[model samples]
Target: MTADGTAPTEEVGGWLDKLGALLRTVGLVVAMGETSLIARNIREPEGATAAGRAMNPGLRQEVVCQPDATGVPWWFWVWQGPTRDAPGELEPLCPAANLEWAAERITRVLAMPEGPP
Candidate 1:
């Protein structure tokens, strides 16, 4: 239900594929967390995880495509609560078709902090 009466043309998994390809080529890990829900999991490259970090530091972000008020779907980054597995906020990034843009933004946000000196 966009401004017009038609449903969104793009499929949710399409975004995953577009973003996954770019992320994978760049050394990031892309995984399908919940296929039924179409959740995409992103993680830091192997050996890049900080030493002595959390139990699971590689996980970067989980993204999904959801519809807006008008029924047009957009990409959104799902943030868990302050603690792992807690409730968090949902922020839309870009349109579903802007898969590359969403991936770039994710990369920037998930970029590992500079190592000591």
Candidate 2:
């Protein structure tokens, strides 16, 4: 339970389910992984940095959702770009109270040509 006496697991699952549905509507395929929900085609980098090249020849965009300390789940736009030493970078998007708001925010970000830092 969280500080507010809410079950974090249940809250997280609810939003994840909503996100899964929204992603399907947008034609973005989502797969349930061990820890996070993985979505494809949401990010694609034009060029590869040295760090990116070191890890892989081509970099792809992916959206991931992971639970955090707060009841609200953390959304991430993964592989936005390469960091100084890391092959890829993860940008924290936002934490929303409900799936609708989260889907809107995610859709807006996904529409952008450039991925977040």
Candidate 3:
């Protein structure tokens, strides 16, 4: 039980680990942090900006799994800028019930080519 008397929710690490492994097999690198997981294209050297851009034009993607005040575990992409009083630039890709589904969505987006199809 939590401090608010509600039952604890399942931790997200296991799901993240599974997703990370899946990404690794396809040549991407997953970096797990305390509060987030970042997946980057690993085909280029770390300092090779031109090569990196040529390989994967999009910036590294991030996923954050955390509970809101109500103890509902929400999964979403980490926004790259400061929060504003207005609506955020990006919306939640998945609901609180499933992180794996969200990860799959991220994978699909990452796999897309940089320009028009």
**Global lDDT scores for all candidate models:** 0.63, 0.59, 0.63
lDDT per residue, candidate 2, 60-114, as tens digits? 2455565446545676666644556665566776663456666666555455355
Q: Pick the candidate with the highest TM-score.
A: 1
Between candidates 1 and 3, name the one with more favorable TM-score: 1
The alpha-carbon lDDT assigned to residue 23 of candidate 3 equals 71
Better of 1 and 2 by TM-score: 1
TM-score quality measure for candidate 1: 0.66
List TM-score per model, in order: 0.66, 0.49, 0.58
- lDDT per residue (tens digit) for residues 1-117 in model 1: 445644444455655677677777666777664321222234444455456345655546777676766677777777777888787667888887786787788777767655543
Q: List the residue pairs that clash in candidate 3.
A: none
Instruction: Report the CA-based lDDT of candidate 2 relative to the real structure.
Output: 0.59
Q: Which residue pairs collide, candidate 2? A: none
